[model samples]
Target chain A: MTARTPDSARDIPEATVARLPVYLRALTSFAEEGTTTCSSEELAVSAGVNSAKLRKDLSYLGSYGTRGVGYDVEYLRYQIAREIGVTHDWPVVIVGIGNLGHALANYSGFRSRGFRVVALLDADPTRKDEVVAGLDVRSFEDIESIVAEHAVSIGVIATPAIAAQAVADRMVANGITSILNFAPTVLSVPDGVGVRKVDLSIELQILAYHEQRKSIAPASEDAS
Target chain B: MTARTPDSARDIPEATVARLPVYLRALTSFAEEGTTTCSSEELAVSAGVNSAKLRKDLSYLGSYGTRGVGYDVEYLRYQIAREIGVTHDWPVVIVGIGNLGHALANYSGFRSRGFRVVALLDADPTRKDEVVAGLDVRSFEDIESIVAEHAVSIGVIATPAIAAQAVADRMVANGITSILNFAPTVLSVPDGVGVRKVDLSIELQILAYHEQRKSIAPASEDAS
Candidate 1:
C-alpha cells in the first residue's frame, strides 16, 4: 500500500464517507451546546462510533485534529461543512405531492442546511389545488420550467413506484444532476447522474436480519 | 484473509448488506417480466453496481450461481429474501400520521416485503379521528395496546421534531426494538434498540457537498 497523503479525501473509503455525515451532525449538536473542542473518544461516544475509526476517518479529509489535544469543534465543523458542500445552498425540487411530499415540503431541515426546496410538484391536476407545507402542489407538467427557473441541480422523487421512472427521466432530462429517490424501485439515470435511494422496507428488513441473528445466537456474545 | 467459504452469507460486509435489497428489487423486476437466471453483468447494470463488486457481494452470499450458467432466478431470490429476514412477515407500526407517516402507511413496498404497518399513532389528540392510508390515525396512547395486539417489534417515527423523541421513548418502553426515524432531530435511544435515520436534507447536503466540490475544483483528482 502507498503512503496516504495529508490532503487526500479520495483515499477515504465509502464506509467512511457515509459516516462523515453522522460525525457532522454530532459536531453540529456539540457546537450548539457551546463546545469548542472535542477528543476522538468524546466525539465517537456521542456519534456512536469507535475512537480510532473516527480519527482515521477524519484523517482522510486532512489532519484537522491536533496530536494529543483534540479537534477544534468550530474549525473542524467548518472544514467538514466545506468538504461536504453545505458551504452554499443547493436548491432542490421535490417531485410528488403525495403524503411523503407533503412531509418533505414541511421539513425545515432542508432550508436549515444548504438545501432549499424550491418546488413541490405532482402529476394529478387535482392536486394543484391543494396547499401543502405552505406551498401549492403544482402539476408535474411544470417541472421543467420550475427546475430551469430555480437552476435546480438536485431533485427529490417521493412519488409512487409507477411514476418514479417517468419522474427520474424528466429530472435527468431537465439537467438535474443528483437525485434522492424515496421510491422503492430501482431508478435508471444516465451515467453522470447520482442517485441515492431511501427505502423503508429495506431498512426494516436489515433490522430484521440482525434481529434474527440475535434470536438465533443465545450465547458467546453480549446478546443484547 | 483466508479463502472465503462458498454458500455462506456471514462474511458479507455492511456495504454489501445495504445493496442486497437493491439487487433483490432488480431481480424482482426481472422475475415479474418472466426472465430466468441473469449473468453478473446484467444484474450489476440493473442494480446500479459494478459487475466485480456485485459478484463479490453475491459470492459472500453463496455460490447460488453456476460457474458458467449464471444465477438461478427463483433460487437466488428466495436465498436473498431469506437472508434479508423478509421471507417471513414482520409486523410494524408507523407513529405520526403526518404526511410522511401517511405515505409510509400507504406505501405497498412494506406490504410486499414482509412488513405490515399495524397502526398509525399521533400524539395530538386531534389527529386521532383522522384517517390515513385506509387506517384510522389513532392517538399516540394506542402504541402499547397496538404493539401488544399486533405483536409489533419495529416502529417508524415520522413525527415532527418535538414529538419524535417522545414517540421513540414510548415505542421503546412498549417493547419496540427497532426504529426508522424520519425526523431531522437526533434521537437518543437506549441500547438494544436499533435506530436508523433517513434525513432528506442530510442526503441532499451530502450531494450538495459533492456538487459544490465540482464547482470549486480548479483541477484535482479527488473523486470522494
Candidate 2:
C-alpha cells in the first residue's frame, strides 16, 4: 500500500495518515481551550490513542514537536492541514436527498473547513421540491454536468444500499475519484479512486463487541 | 504501548476487532443473498477490505475456512459472532431522545445483533409525552437504577455537544465502561474504559482531505 510515486521522499503510511486527522482534531480542542502546547501523553489521552503511537505517528511527518516540552498546538495543526491538502478550497457534491442526506447537507462543518458543497443531486423528481441546507435539490442525472461545471472530485452517497453502487459508478464515470459512502453496502471502485465508508451500524456493532467484553470482566479496576 | 498481560496474543487488537463487525455485516449480506460459500476475494470485495488483510485477520481466530474452497457463510458468520460476543444479548442504553437518537433506537441492526435497547434517557422533562421507538422517554435521574437493573455495560451518547460529556460522566459513574459517542467532542474517559466516536464532521473532513489531493494531482490515469 506504500507504493510511492516517482521522485518522492517516501509517503506517510495510510494508517498514519488516518491518525493525523485524529491528532489534528485533538490539537484543535486544545487550541480552543487556550492550551498552547501538549505532551504526547496529554494529546494521546484526548485523542484516545497511546502516547508512544501518537509520537511515532507525528514523527512520520518530521519532528514538529519540541524534544522535551511538547508540540505547539497551532503549529502542529497547520502542518497537518498542509499535509492533508485542506489549505485550499475543495468542491464537493451530495448525490442523495433522503433523511440522512438532509442531515449531511445541513451540516455546517463542510463550509467551516475547506470543502464547499457545490450541488445536491437526487434521483426522484418529487424530491426536487425539497431545499436542504439552503441549497435546492436537483435531479441525480445532472451529476455529470455538475461535476464538469464545478470540477467536483469528491461525492457523498447517502442513498439506500441498492442505489449506492449505481451512484458510485455514475460518480466515477463522471470523473469523480473520491467518495464518502454512508450507505450500508460495500462499494467497488477501481484502484486510485479512494473510498472511505462511514457505516453507522458497523460503528455501533464495534461498540457492542467491547461492551460484551466489559460485561464478562466487570471488575472496574482490572486494567489487565 | 504494548502493555500486554502474560497472555498477550489473547487480547484481540482493537483495530482488527473494529473490522470484524464489518466482515460480519458482509457475511450477513451474503447469507441474505443465499451465498453459502465465498472465496476471500469475493468476501473482500463485499467487506471493503484487502483480501490479504482479511485472510490474515481470520487466521488469528484459527483456520475456519477450507484451503481448497472457501468459508461456509453461515459457519463463518456464527464463528465471528461468537468471537465478538454478539451471540449473547447485550443491554444498551440510549442517552438522548433527539431525532438521531430516535432513529438509532429504532434501528433493526441492534435487535438483529443481540443488542437490546433497555431504555431511552432524556434530560428534557417536557419530552415525556413523546414516544420514540416504542419506548417512553425516561427521565435522566433513572440512569443509575436502569443501569443497575439492566447491567448495561455499553452506552450510546447521542446528546448534543454541551450535554454529551455530562451524560458520559453519569454513564461512567453508573458503571458503563464502553461508550459510542455520536457527539462532535473528543470525550475524556478514565483508564480501562473504551470510547468509540462517530463524528459526522470528522468523517466529512477526512473525505475532504482525500478529495483535495485528487484536485492537486494530474488527471492522467496511471494504471498502477
Candidate 3:
C-alpha cells in the first residue's frame, strides 16, 4: 500500500467515509464541552466506536493522534470538517414539499451543519407561494433556474415512491449531482451522480430482525 | 468457520444483517413485477449491490441459489422475511408529535412493512387528543399502559435532543427493547437494549464529504 497524504480524498474506504461524520460529531461535542485535547479512547467512546477502529479510520484521512499528549480538539474538529467538506456551507434544494419535506425544510440541523436549504419545491399548483422554513414553495419546473441561481450541487427528494425517480432525473439534469432520497424506491442515476437512500421502514425492519433474535435466544449478544 | 444452519440468527455478521432488508426489498420488487425467479446479478442490480456480495450475504442465512435456475423469488422472499422477523407486524409507538413525528405517523410504508403504529405520544398537554394519521395523540405519561396494552417492542424517539434520553429511559422501562432515535443526541441505553440513530444532518454531511471530493478531483470514482 502507498503512504496516504493529507487532504487526499482519493481511495478512502467507503466504510471509513461513513464513519467520518460520526467522528466529526464526537469532536464537535468535545469542543463544545470546553475540551482542549482528548485521547483516542476518549473520542472513540464519545463516537460509539472502538479506539483501534477509530484510529484506523482517522489514519485514512492522514490524522494521527500524538502519543501521550493526545489530539487537539478544535484542530482535529476543523480537520475533520474540512475533510468532510463542511468548512463552507453548501446550498441545497428540496423537491417534494410533502410532510417529510416539510420536516426536512424546518430541520435546523441542516442549516447548522454545512447545508443551507435554498428552495422548497412541489408539483402541486396549490403549494406554490406557501411559506415553509422561510422559503416560498416553488414549482418543480423551476428546478433549472433554482439550481443555476443558488449553485446547488445537492438536492433532497422527499416525494412519494412513484415520483422519486422523476424528481431525481430532473435534479440530475439540472446539475444537482448529489441526492439524499427519502423515497422508498430504487433510483437509477448516471455514472457521476451520487444517491443515498434513507428508508425508515428498512431501518425498523433491521431493528426488528435483531429484536426477534433476542427473544428467541436470550443468550445472544446485545446489539451495541 | 463451522457449517451454518438455517434459522440460526445467532452469528450473522452485522454488515450482512444491515443488508438483509435491502435484499428483502429487492425480492419484494421482483415479486411485484411478476418475476418467479431471478439471477444474482439481476437481484444485485435491483438492490444496488454487487452480485458476489449479495450472494455472500444470502449465504449467511443458509440460502444458496441454484446453478442455472437462480433463486425462487417467493421462497427467498419468505425466508428473508422470516429471518428478519417481519413476517408479522410488530407494534410500535412514537413519542413526539412534531413535524418529523407527524411525518412518521402518516408514513404508509411502516404499515405495509411489518410495523403498526399503536399510539402517537407527546409530552405537551395541548397535543393530547389531537388526531394524527387517524390515531389520537396520547399523553407521554400513558406510555407504560400503552406499551403493556399493545405489547409494543419497538419505540421511536422523535423528541428534541433534551428530551430524547428521558423518552428512551421510559421506553426501556416499559419493555420497549428496540428504539429508533431521530433526535440529534447520543443516547445511552443499558445492555440488551438496541438503539439506532437516524440523523438527517449526518447523512447530508456524508454526502457533502463525497460531493466536496468530487468537485476537488472530478477524476475520482463515483459514490455508489
Report the number of the highest-lDDT candidate. Answer: 3
TM match of model 3 to true structure: 0.92
Candidate 2 residues B1-224, lDDT tens each? 56534431346778888889889989999999999999998888888789998998887676799998999999999988987878887898998877567767777667877689999999999987678778889998999999999998889998887799999999999999889998877788887678888876666666666666655666667568
Clash pairs, candidate 2, are none
Models 1 onward score TM values of: 0.86, 0.84, 0.92
Q: Per-residue lDDT for A1-224 in model 2, tens only?
A: 45545332335787887777778778888999999998999999988789989988887777788988988999998888777767677788998877667766866666766678999999999999688788899999889899999988888998888899999999999999889998888889988788888877677678777666665653757566
Q: What is each candidate's fraction of native interface contacts (fnat)? A: 0.57, 0.48, 0.76
* Model 3 lDDT at residue A99: 92
Stretches of model 2 off by over 4 angstroms after superposition: A1-10, A36-45, A49-52, A62-72, A215-224, B1-11, B50-52, B67-69, B125-128, B215-224
In angstroms and one decimal each, the interface RMSD of every candidate reads 2.1, 2.8, 1.2
Cα RMSD, model 2: 4.7
Quality of candidate 2 docking, DockQ = 0.42
Clash count for each candidate, listed in order shown: 2, 0, 0
- Please give, for residues B1-224, the per-residue lDDT of candidate 3 as tens digits: 57555457557889998899889988998999999999999999998899999999888877557887899999999998998999999999999999999999999999988999999999999998899999999999999999999999999999998899999999998899999999988888998899999999988988998788776785535456
Per-residue error for B75 in candidate 3, Å, reads 2.5
Using TM-score as the yardstick, the better of models 1 and 2 is: 1
After superposition, which runs of candidate 3 have C-alpha atoms over 4 Å from their true positions?
A1-11, A63-66, A218-224, B1-10, B63-67, B218-224
Ranking by DockQ: 3, 1, 2
